[model samples]
Every structure is written in structure tokens, then in C-alpha cells.
Target: MFTSPFQDYVIDAAQRTVLFWDVMRARGNQYVEHTAQDAPHVLSYDFEPVMAGTDLPSPVNYGLVRIEPPKGVKVDEAKRPFVIIDPRAGHGPGIGGFKADSEIGVAMNAGHPCYFVGFLPDPVPGQTIEDIMKAEVAFIEKVAELHPDASGKPTIVGNCQAGWAAMMLASYRPDLCGPIIVAGSPLSYWAGVHGKNPMRYTGGLLGGTWLTALTGDLGAGKFDGAWLVSNFEGMNPANTHWSKKYNVYKNVDTESERFLGFEKWWSGHILLNAEEMQWIVDNLFVGNRLPTAEVETTDGVRLDFRNIRSPIICFCSHGDDITPPQQALGWILDLYADVQDIRACGQTIVYAVHPSVGHLGIFVSGGVAKKEHREFASNIDLIDCLPPGLYEAVLTEKTEDTPDADLVATDYIARFETRTLEDIRALGTNSEEDERRFATAARVSDVNKGLYQTFAQPWVKTLITEEQADLMMKIHPARLEYTMFSDKNPVMGVVKSMAKIVRSNRKPVERDNPFLVAQEQMSDMIIRSLDNYRDMRDNAIEALFLSIYANPLLQATVGLSADEKPPRARPGRSPEHIELVKRKVEDLKARISHGGVREACIRAMIYIGQPDSAADERRFEFIRSLRKGVPGELEAFKLTVREQFFMLLIDESAAIAALPDLLKGHADEIEQGIAFVRQVASTGGEPSDAVKERLSEIEKVFNTALCTKR
Candidate 1:
């Protein structure tokens, strides 16, 4: 180990040199590639290219159109067309169909006709965001026209920023949409877990839209999306600076091709017009407008999340730092007082949060795309079928067999429960005062933004030029990796060749190696030091800024902002189909007390419950969301998991009641697990029939075995 330490210093120094040399070599190699492949893919939305001859419908051509069709995707005319809208936040489109186990791939595999919503760098003449939205509507209409036999409407999938954009489109034209599956969207800007995801707070800390206006001016009326991508990478300095590069370097032999492919797309950062960026910041990030119905497009048209009739299925992740569960969900709190308000509006909003997936994984991770996106695509109808309500989606991936032998295999389950506004509220603990304060912030932002535009924008724009604008855009940190590494240059070709050789010759040390262990230890120490600095920096900023901005006196100066509050609940339950669900829960509880597999099964089925007794009061809130064009049969779906579960187990009670405890001696633990199950059931929006049936059978065995003993 002593010799190893001496050897490690030498190796580390050598590695550092190699790393620096590689960067230079890579840059030289990129010069060659960039010169050679500097050509952009001139987009044409007019022609659909066929890579392979297939029986599936011909793909639509977005020409420079921004959309990609899966190579062998086939469509089922009987099902709704699946239109996946790609985010133009920075990178190009096609991530939706980039893999066979993707959102588009799954939709096509399920026999649903699919389409992509893409765009070009240059707008079509005078095209604006509203124009793009109209184009989306047109694409949906075209798909719908093609599938006249489809009983259901097209289910639209939108990822990240596109999710909110798609939601905006749906709100504008509810008739054209079916279900909107929003993956990793930050609809609720202020709704974040403390101590993490402080990016939203950045604008607030930066003193609002001043920088945005300045950046727009600097870009000569165009806000390069590269900056946005850079910001995303900047949030995770470790991942950006070391982990990412190290992962590729350590696994270069395998990672090179994958890295190149991803970087090709990732580096293809797009540009947004100043008008659009300004709107996004002033309204979304700063104003908090969509949920509040206070936004208007440049054309003077109003924006209202409540106007849409479709159901919205929001898919976010707890581990997703970019668009955390709170950001994805907080808009509900921003928009409505309770779920009853949602029901009164006849909307259906369903949200599913993964326990631990990161932001990109939500859309690109094959497992997630296959299971979550696949199930969501398959059961758009079932989700649409759910009665108007707030639902939590819980997916149970079918495994082969457990070591415990208590379960069966080969299943994909979608469990749903009807929820209320209060239940949705229960997810967080933000008080009414906090919300009021946020509202005040929103109003202040509007005034600040308006003042800047009226007084400062013209001078800023005149001072910046188009050439400088283009130069600035090209060099943005986000685009640097791509622009710097292409195969177009001559020098890069030689270095690329050498790099490949070196990569092939590389072999990592053993996990237990002293050097490897020391490397980890040292890297961790650096990371810890950096984290401390980061905490200190962030706390200093927050403390200084809060004293300056988030103030009671300033709030008082803002004035009368509380008058425009979200809708209030109608007090008690309105006696919708809720009573039936309640009765089912009570019955299921009783059935479980009786022993036997059949009885247990009956108990499981009979007890399927609506988690919130207040569901009926909030019916309007969900109904309104559903009507906004979210997919599924909104009126016919079950509201509670208890109801859904009871429906599953009760009928098969007799057969199961005859057997031993299916959960075995873990009956108490199993029974005690009901709280989580109830929560899962409550939030799980809709289950596919396969899952529903499996739960019934499990209950059957559970009922008969446990009942006889009792």
C-alpha cells in the first residue's frame, strides 16, 4: 500500500497530462469534423422519408420539420393516434422515437397510429409559438382524419418544456386532443423541495426579467436555447465536469459511439425568438400565470389551464432535480383551492411520480419508457375512462418470480385511485400564507417585467447586433462540446483515430485497488469541499435576497393581489357517485375480517376505496381537467383504489377463502401494509384489465386460505 501511494501520485500526474492532452487532441480532431460536417440538416416538413418498406402508415414530413417517425412503427386504426411533441428547449427533436423502447415506439408497438410534432430552426415565414400550436393542432387533425375508425382520440405525449407547451395548446383547442402525457414538466414553478432545485429561484434572486431582457437584446431578438441547456448542466457541476467525462473515459471503448450519438442530438441546440423567451419567463417562471389564467399570447389571446377539457397525466420523478414532483404538481395548488374546484370545472388531472428516476431517465431510460410510457400509451383509454378526478398513478412492474413465492409473474399493472383537491394538497405542507405570498410575488413580477419592457428594451436591442448574436449563440457552453468535437476537421480525424486506439487499449483497475480506492477518497473530499462552498454561497444569496425581495412590507405595497384567488370548495360532498365508492370501501373492510382465501379476496375487492371522502366535492376540478382533452373515458372510471381493489377481490372470495394465507405468516404485516396500499390505490388513476384481474386472483387465494383459519 505504501508503494501504491507513491505509484498513485505518479499515475495521477500522468493521467492528468493525458486528460489535458486528450482535450487538446479532441479539440483538434473536432476542428476537422466541424469543418467537414458543419452542414446543418436543412429541415423540410414537407416530405416523409421511408427508410424501410413496411405495412404501417406513411410518416408525416415536418421538413426540417423536427419530427421523427420510428423505423417500423405500425398503427392500429381502431386506437387513437399517438402524437409525441418534442421539446425545443435546446436540443433537437426525435428523442421520443430515438429508441425502439420509446414513447413513440411503444405507441406504435401497441398498434396505435403514431405521429411526431417537430419544428425547424427558422420559423415558417412569420411563424410564432401560437403558429406552432396551431400546426400541432393541424397535425392532430390530420392524424384523426387518417384514423376514422379509431373510437378514441389521439393521445399526445409531451416531454419537459414541451409538456407545458402542449398543455397550452390543449387548453387552446381541447377538441383536437385526447390525453396529454406530460413527462418531467415543471408546471408548478415555485413548488420545490427546500434546499434543492433552486434554479426557479434564480430569476427571483437575479431580480426578475432584467437579465432575460438583456439576453434577448444581446441575441438581437433571438434567445439562444443553448443558454438554457447550459443552465441545466451547470446545476450538476460534478456530473458535468467529472462524472460525465469520467464515465465515458473509463468506459470509452463502449461509450464512444453512444456518447457521440447522444452528443450529436444533445449538441444540436436550437434557438427561440425573444418574444417567446420573454413570454416564457414573464408568464411562466416569473409571473406564474398559466395556472392563474392571467397570461396572454402576443396576439392578445388569453391563456388558461382550466379552459382545456382533456385529462392531463403528469409524469414526474422525486429524484428529478430539473422538474421535481413538486414543480410538476404545484400548479394544482396554484390554480385551485381544492379538488372540488377541479371537479366543478369538469377536469381530470392525473399525476404519477417515480420513486427515484432522474429527469432525463423519465423520458429516455428504457425501463421507464417501456413500463411507464408503454402502459400509459396502452391504457390511454382506461385513463380517459376514469371518472373525472385527481388520480395518482402507481405502476407495478411484473417480475418473473419472487424468492418469497407469494406472487406470480409476467404482468404490467396500472393502479389508479380517485383523489380530491385536499388529498392533492396533502402531498405538501405549504400554508395558505405561503401561497398568498407567492401570489404577491407573481403580481410584482408582472409589474417589474412591464416596466422593463416599456422603458429599457429598445435601448438594449439597438446596442446589440445580429453577427455578435450569432457568435454568442455558437459559443454558448452547452453547444461547445458538439461544435468543438465534430469529424469535419482534418486534425480531429488523426486525434480521433488515436483516441479510438487508446480507448481500445484501456483497462480499468480492480475495485479493491489502492489507487482506485484513493481516487474515490480524494474525489469525494473535493466534492465535499465544493458542496460546502455551494451551500455557503446559496444560503448567503437566499438570506440577502429574502431580506430584499420576499418581504411583508413589499407585499403590502403590492396590494389587493389576494382578490384574484383560486376557486373555493363547495363545503361538503355533492352526492355524486361517491356514496357508492364509500359503501364499497366499508363492505371490503368487513369482508376482510372474515377468514378464507375467498373471504380475503372478497375483502380486497369489496374494500377498494376512494382515498378522499371529499372526492365528490372536487368532482368539478377533475371533470374540467378531463374535458380539457386528457385521454380516457373520463366519466366511467373508478375514483378510489379501494373501489378498484374491492372490485378485484370481492367476487373471487369463495375460491381463495378455502386456501391457507397467501401472504403466509406475514398476514399481520400484509394487512398492516394497507395504509401504503390505500395510498397507492388512492393515487393509482386507472388499472389495465390484466392488473385488475391479477389482483382479483391474488385476493381469491388470500380469501380462501385466511378465511378457513379464522
Candidate 2:
């Protein structure tokens, strides 16, 4: 018999409440179990430890582990191994491989040996960031040693906080890394659009990281990572306080396991050394030093991102409020004057901007792994072969009508379109006045930090005992919520029994029940209210931050009034570097017409590719499949491509005219060469009129050279 709507609502509500409490009880139990296990990690795949940082000369909590491929997944040891480093910003390790479909799975599925670089919950006492860097280098070196016959150096994948870390390692030891992928990592901390990114205003509004120092001191010299986790939760108050729990409560039967699993990782907060936190705040966050090459090692070795020799791929999203596209890609503007500077330095940089994906989604989302990351892994060789310039990595979903669909190995087709500095600038950036405000904030941070260290730090350190600090961490709202709902709590025993009885007599409501619909509407209204309040609060914080920091008096006090240049000023290239660029271009100009049919064919391909300013994987794959008539390896082909590309950039007219000179002896094969170039170029689709014109020019050159030889 059908029940009344009101009776169904009462039964469903009662059952949901019991199941929700039971899930919370389960989450607490999992938290307890996870903490009890030594070296706890959330990886779904099994792995064996390779090396610990403690085994190194300078110990850290970090360790390297080799992932064992799952059933039916065969890894090719001859291929370059992949090393994935997860972010240690408040959370414990294994985010990169916590699920079957993740960064680790992508590389492993692609037949590459995979390794993970993760850290323990607690840092080795007195361990610094430099130690972690050194440990990472050692881990990569070990991987290379294990695969002596590998094709190249290990590819490094750094997610979020680890992205900047990967960049640093590549810069410090360029030869140790192959291609570098930095996903959702903020390199330029001060960059953001005015009203859209309220997080950038936080440091300034909080009086410039003084609270960070105070918290560290209160923690008895250790910085509680729960504080960082709290900050992230604070970004979306509705989700933190209401919607997250409400969704689980509403769908308790099916959503409980997933909720508990995610909470296991989320609630496992770690620790950072007070000194380490201070250095990060001083150097990267407030000082904004990494992008400008102002950071150096203890031994005075300058860490310049420009010095990295490998191809760097940046993945960011427009939907990520924490690390927006500006912060992820703005460092390019900070480092180079324009795209010419990038090419002149012999660097290949590619970036992709997702229309909508949150920061964590960039790393852990299964859909992201299947599409973006799979494409990246499959086309890594193409990325390596790309000529030194700025290119945007665009992934188009493959369809039945896609051009050259048979050539695409994956579900998506990847393309690297040539981009310019204007493209990055079009995203968004701060004005000169806005930059001045951030500069003032940085100056104020330094002053405030100094004052805390001198006056407040000593007394706080003396007053907070280790036991007292431990109690404070235990009582932290973020942690307390989990512990309070655990099995250890006497009150949860009743909840567990009640949940079991409800499950035995479960009677779920129909989808169209009036009361259920009304309940959802109420939830929507609550969320809307919370979101609006958040917006207003953020707007007020932003306005207050601008008013205080933009004050001329405060600016003058912080040594900004007399300076006409922006605070985070762009550093110009040195005379020696300029001379080096000139020498390199002159060298390429001298060798404008030097090669065989291979060089002519590559030149033709790149020449036609310029019209559309894009080249897809199909075209690149076709080029790679060409016969090795020339006595050279893949690296040789890459070098030839770069040389010919540079020749074009130096003098396009001369580079084209010299094609006949390259094919001087091979004039008999001119027709075959044209067919080859035309075939490879058409993989993307039918060529434009401009491309046809270029192809016609090449034909004329081939005919003229053939006749002259005859």
C-alpha cells in the first residue's frame, strides 16, 4: 500500500539522520585506523619503498617508491620512467595515485615505469626545503641508474605545490629531468584579476603573515598544517559548513563510502617546520622571488627558471580560484619580454587552460586523468620534439568527423598551437598601481616578520610547552570534528546500533515526493544565502585591503613613494646574456642552408604549419613514422627540427630560398619530397590558401633545383 507523503517524509528523514551519523562514525574509525598505520598513505595501488630521505646525507620525511603495475598492465623499462610528486600543502601523501585512474595510472598505462615521491606526516626535525630538493634529485638519479638503457631522463610531474618544486629541481639540475609538467601550481603569487580572485588579498588583509609566525610559535616550533587546511575550507564556507554534509546526509546510502574515503585523506593533516614555513612565506609567497630568479641555494647557486632546458608544460584552469591562470602562467611575462625572448633562449613552453576545473580537480579528477593527462602522456615525445617557442596545448575531443581520426591513438586529439605573449596578457594581470600595492604588502611583511621574531617570538616559545601545544592541536576545530564522532566516543555506540536497525527496515521516499522536493529547495536557498554572504565578505576584505595598502602614506613609509618603477620590477637581461643570444642567432643564420632531403622536408612542414599556427599529434606522428634514410636518432631529428625552425625565425625568406641548396644532390627525389610534405601537412585537414601558396613556392624551388642539376 502507498503511504501518505507526510508519513514517507518522516520515515525517510529519520533513516537519513541515522545513516549520516553512522557514516560520520565510520569516518572517525577510518581516521583512527589510518593514523595507527606507520607511513600511512592513500594510494589505491600497491608500491614498494625505493629510498627514504633519511637514508640520504640530509634526511627529510620524503621517500621514493616504485609503483607496481596492476594486472594486465605491462611497463616498458626501456621507456623513460615517470616520477610524480604530490603537493605537501597541509595534506599527507598519495593524492596523485589515491585512485586507480590518476597520474600514476596514466603513466603506468602508457607502459612507462612509475615512481612516486611522497612525504611522511611529520618532517624530520630541522629539515629545510633545500634538503627536500636534494632528496628529490637523488631519487631521480636513482631511477635513471636503475634504467641504464632508457631512452632519456625521467619525466617529472609536479602537482600544485610540487609544481614549483619541480621547476626548481629542473633549473638546479637541468640534465636530470626530461619534460616538466606543472599542474595548477602558482608561480606568480601576486597575480590575479581584481575582484575575481579574493585570495590574493588575504595576505595583505591579515597584516602580512604575522599570524603565521604567531601560530608557529604557539605550536612549539612546528607549524600545524591543519591551519592551511582550514584556510582552504574557509574559501567556500557553504561547502565547508553545510552543503558537504548535507549532500552526504541526503544520499547517505550510496555516498557514505566515497565521503569517508575522501575524508580519510582530507583529515590527515601534516606538519611543517616553523623555519621551513617562514622561508616559504618569505621567499615565494610574500617576496615573489621564484619567477624573477631572485632565489638562490645556500652555496650561492642561483635558481633560475629560465635555466631549465626541458620542455615545460603548464596545466591550469579558469575555474580554479586558488591558483588561477594568471598565477600559473604569469611567470612567463615576469621572466621574458616576449615570445622572441623565449625562442632566443632555446626554450619550449606549452600551456593549457581548462574552461572549468577546480584546483584539486586538476590532479585527482578521474575525468582529467582520462583526457588531459592521457593526451599528455601519449604525446610527450611530440612535446619534446617541438621547436623552442611558446605554444598552447589544446585537446579536442575526438569525434567520428575528426580529421585524421584513425591516426589518433587516444579519445582526444592533442594540438600545440603557436602562441604569443599577447595571448597570456589577454588573460588578465594587475595594473602598475596594483603591483605597487602588492610590493608595499611584501615590504610590510618583512617588517612585521622581523618584529615578531625579535619581540613576540621569544616569549611565546617560552610559554607554550610541548604538551600544551599538543592539546591545542587536538582541540583544533578541523581535527576535533573527526575525533568527536569516532567509535571511541561513548555516544556513537547508540548511533551505530540505530543505523543498523534503520538499514534493516529502510524505506526510501520516491523521487517526486512533495516533501523531498521541498527539502531540496530549502537546501538550495540555504546555499544561495551562504554564497551571497561569502561574496559580500570577500568584497569588503578586498576593498579594505586596497584602501590600507594603496595609501600613499603607507607606501612612502614602506619605501615606495620615491620609486617610479613598480615594486615587483622586471629584471632586464644582462649584457653577457644578450651577447649570447646574438651569437646563437648569428650561428643559426650562418648555417641557413645546411642539410639533406630530411631538412628540406622538415622546413616545408614547419613553413606550411605557420599559416594556421597549429600542429596536431597526427602531423607530428606522421613525421616520426617517416623512414630513417638519414643516419640519426630521435634526438638528431629533434635537433634538426629546432635548427630549421630557428633558421626560419631568423630569416624566413632566406630559409625558404635555401631549400634548393639543401636538396642540391637529391634533386631526382623532388616530386617524392613534395608528396611527402603534402601528405604529412594534410593530416590535420585540408590546407588553407596560405598553406597551398607555401606548398607552391616549395614546388617551384624543387623544380628550379632539379632543372639546374639536369
Candidate 3:
């Protein structure tokens, strides 16, 4: 007998309801189990502890562990190791290596040793950021000790919040780090477009960060990370309030495992010392000091980002609402007035913007892991060899039309294309008015914080005992949401049994059922309504913030003038820096004609490849294939490449003209060298007219050198 649509709907709905409740119960049970296990991280790979932060002089919850490569994976100890630091913003660490397709996986697959720097659920008493930095340096030193034969220092990757920490570490000890990659990190705090980036307005709407201070005080000197997670959820109301639950309700059987897996990490909220949290807010979020070299250590050393000597790679995404392209790339604009400033600092900065990935997806998404991360890991050497300047990392999938396809090692072709400050500005930034408003907000925050500390903090701290703080954390909505649905709840026992019975006799409605279609339409309507509400709320907040902080009277009260320049306006180059640049330029000029066959070959490749304004793996790989032996140690070769690149940059004409002199004694090698460069020049495709012209110039130089030798 065929049932009516109503009957089908009733039966299917009943089963789904039971299954949804069961999934929630399972999630609760998993949370309990996870906590019982002391919330072991979600890293898919097994690991052995290398060093514990607690063992250091200034103890911390952080630890460094070495990952054991999975079956069939071989690690080369001689290759530079990879040390990944996952963000400890709210959740526990291991997001960077929680699955097979992750940062750790990519490095291991590439035959590099991998280490993870993660933290425990709680901080050591009075532990500070400086202590963590010390631990990080020690961990790196240990890695270096372990890999004495490695060709280069470890490549450090910082995901999300760890991005800033890694940058600080690199700036603090540039000699200890190799390439530094920061994924989904916001270095420039006040950078965002009006109307679109509402998160930047949040602090202003809240009247600044005094609330953060109050929360830390109320928590009895320990900040509960659940509050941070709650703030993140508030950014997307539809997802937090309805869609995530509805997804599981709609596809309970298939989604439960993935949901449980993610919840293992998402629900693992850690703690931070009140001092640590307060320092982060006052120095970074509100003070906005890190980018401009205003942040200093307790010992008084300035943490200037320009001091970082290694290649810095920024990976962000357009679709990421949290760390948008503006916030990720804006610091470049803040620190350097022009590309020459970057080159003067001897810095190589590369950035990659994903077209549509979300913030977390930049680090955790499998597709990104396979493509972007993989390409980055493989082409790191190319990045290291690049000259000091700004470049964009572009990855394109290989195709049959690709030239010299056989020489390509990976499935994608990686290119580093030159970029300029205009490109970063084009991503969108705050106007002058917006800057004034943010500055006003900062000033207001300072006043409010002072008031609270003087008036409210003492009383709150005195009244809020450890027991009360513990109770408050237990009853927090974020934690309660999981606890209330667990097997410990008497009502869940009934739902659990019902779920088993329903699973045994499942009755799923067909997709075309009128009731099912109606259900989907209702869901869409609900989602739209919530999204509209979110948009309205954000707009109102933005408007309110501007009205309160952007007023001329209020700006004046905050000591901001109508003619105040944007916060990111950089001062002119220092006299000392200018002298240094001049000296470096002169030094490079003197070495224009001081290289052998290897230098000539690298310079020729760089010169010919200059027309495309890009460097590709195919060309680099072809060069490697032709070399019967390495010219020297990898470090020496890197120095040679950098020297030649700078020589070309400082005086391309002189550098190319002098190449014939350097190749004079190697007349017999001239034909082979030219052939090698020509083949590499054509690796990506048929050489463009400009590339062909450069190649002809190289040929003429080589021929002249040969004739001169005769």
C-alpha cells in the first residue's frame, strides 16, 4: 500500500528526530571521553615528545613533539625539518596535523622531518608570552641539534594566531629560522573595509576591551577560552544558531562521525593566564603595536618585523571573514613605503590569496592541503632563492599544453609573480575617517580600562573565588550545550534506545516527497531570516561605532585631530637605514663581475625569466636535472643565487655585460650553458617575444666570451 505524503513525513521525521538526539548524546559522550583522556590532541599521526615547555626555566603548558611518519613515508634527516605551531586561540592545538592530509602530512610526504609545537589545556602559573618565546627558541635549538647534517634551518609554519607568534620568534632570532609561512593571520589589526568587515567594529561597539579585562578578573585570574569560541560563533548567527544543528538533523547518519571528529577539537577549550590575555589585548588588538615595531620584550628589545631575515609567506583567503585579505596583507603597506624599502631590508615577502577558502580551511581543508600547501612545501627552495622584494605565490594546475611537462615534479606549476604596494591597497583598507574612528576607539578603551581597574576590578576579584569561577565556567552556555545533551542526562537514555530501534527499522522519505521539499524550503527560509538579522545587526553595530567614535568632539577628546594621518603612514627612511642601503648597493655593484660558470648560469636564467616576471618549478627542476653534480654545498649555492639576483637587481646591465668576462675561461662550457638556459627558458611554454629577446642577448654574450677566449 502506498502511503500518503503526510504519513511518510511523520515516519521519516520521527526517525530523524531520534537519530539527531542520539548524535547529540554521542557528541556529549565523546566530549566526556575526550576530557577523561586529558583531551589528547586530534593529530592523526603518532608522536613522541621531544621537549616540554614545563622543563624550561620559565615553565609553560606548551610542548614540542616529533611526528612519526606514517607507513610508507620516509623522512630525510638531511632535508630541512618542518616545525608547525597551531593556534592556541581558544581550542586545543593539532589543527595543523589532525588529519592525514595536513601540514605534517605534506612535509612527511616530501621526506622532511616534522615536529609539532602544541600546548596543554592550562597555562603554568604566571607564564607569559616571553616565556613561550624562550621555549620556542629552545625547541628550535633542539631540532637543530637533532638535524646537524640538515642543509638549512627548519621551515616554521604558524597557523592563525600562531602566525604572529612565529613572526615574533623569527624577528627575535632570524638566524634560527628558515622560510616563515603564516596562514590566516591578522598582522595589521585596524585594517578592513567599511560595511564589509564588521568584526573590526566589534571592540568599538563594546566600548573597547575593558570587557576583556573584566572577564579575566571574573574568571579568577584564568581566562576561559569558551568565551573566545563564543565570540567566533557570534560572527555567523545562522550557522551557530540553526544551520549546524539542522545539517546534522537533515543528514544524521552520514554526518555524525565528521561532526564528532571536529567537535573533539572545537569543544576542547583551554585556559590562559589573565596577564597573558590582558597583554594580548592591550598590545595587539587595541594597541596595534606589533606591525610598527612598537612592541618590545620585557628585556627592552624591539620586536621589529623587518628584522626577520627569512622569506615570509602569507597565506590568506578572500572568503575568510575573520582574517580577510586586507588584514593579512595590510602590514606590508604599514612597514614598507615602497618595494625598495623591502629590498633595502633584505626581505623577501610572498603572499598567496585563495579565491574562496574560509579562514580555518586555509589550514585544515584537505583540498588546500593537497594543492596549496603541497606546492608551498615543494617550492620552498625556489622561494628561498628569490631576491628581496614583494611577490605573489600563484599555483596553476598542470595541463597537457604545459611546456617541458616532463620536467615538472608536481601536478601544479608554482610561480612567484612580482607585486607592488598598489596591489595590496587595491584589496581594500580603511579610509582616513575609519582610522580616526579606530584611534578614538583605542583611546576610549584606555580610559574605560583605567576606570574599570580603579573602580570595578578590585571588587569583582575579591568576590569571585575559585569555586565560583569554576561554577561559572561549568554553566557557560558553550559548555552547557554539550553537557546537557550527554548520556548523563536522564532523558537521553530514552532517546538513545529509541535511536537504536529507529536505525534498525529506518524509514527515509524520498527527495521528491512534497513534505520533504516543504521542509527544505522552510529551512532555507529560516537560514535567510537569520542571515538577514545578522546583516542588520552588523550594520547597526558599524553605524553605532562610527557615530560614537568618529564624532569630531569625541576624536578631539581622544586627542585625535581632524587632520590626523592614517595610522599606517610610514615615516621616511631613517638616515642610518639609507646609509646601509647605499653601502649594500655599492657592495653589490663591486661584485657585478665576480662570479664563475655557476653564477653566469643562474644570472642568465634569472635574466631570461625576468620578462614573464615570474619563476616556475619547471624551469628550476630542469636546471636541477641538467646538473650532474651540485656546484657546492646547498648553503653556498643559496648565497650565490642571492648574490647574483641582487647583482641583477642593482645593475642588470653591468651584471649581464660582465657575465661574458666571468665565463671567459670556460669557453668550452659556453655552448652547454647557453643550451641549458635556453631549455629552461622554454620549460613553461614557448618563450614570449620578450623572453626570446633576452635569450638572444645571453647567446650573444656567450659567443662574445668564446671568441674573446680564442
Ranking by TM-score: 3, 2, 1
In order of appearance, the predictions have TM-scores of 0.72, 0.97, 0.97
Q: What are the C-alpha RMSDs, in order, of all predicted structures? A: 11.2, 1.7, 1.6
Full ranking by lDDT: 2, 3, 1
Scored by lDDT, model 2 comes in at: 0.89
- Stretches of candidate 2 exceeding 4 Å from the true structure: 627-632, 667-672
User: How do the residues 1-710 of candidate 1 rate in per-residue lDDT, one tens digit apiece?
Assistant: 34565465455444443544455455435433432442333222222532211111322223222134445654556667787777878766667776677786777777776666665553332345565665666667777777765757778888998898888888878778888899999886766644666666677666677678778789888777778878887777777777666666444435655665455456666677777777788778876666666667666766677766778999988789898887888777766677656754557788887889989889888888778888777667667755556887766654444221122112465556666667655656344554554556666676777787889888877777889888887676665565455454455566656555655554344456667677678777767776676677666755654555547677667773334443221133337535754675567555443443223322343343322322221222223333344343333233342233433434445423422543455455444433333333323245445545655554455444445446
Cα lDDT tens digits for candidate 2, 410-497: 9999989999999999999989988989989989988898898899888999999999989998899988888889988999999999
Residue-level lDDT for 212 in candidate 3: 90
Looking at model 1, residue 304 earns an lDDT score of 70
Q: Candidate 3 lDDT, tens digit per residue, 564-645?
A: 6764455456688789888988998987887778889888888888889887877777665654245335667578878888
Residue 177 miss distance in model 1 (angstroms): 1.0
Candidate with the greatest lDDT versus the true structure: 2
Error of 2 at 476 (Å): 1.3
lDDT (Cα atoms) of all candidates against the true structure: 0.61, 0.89, 0.87
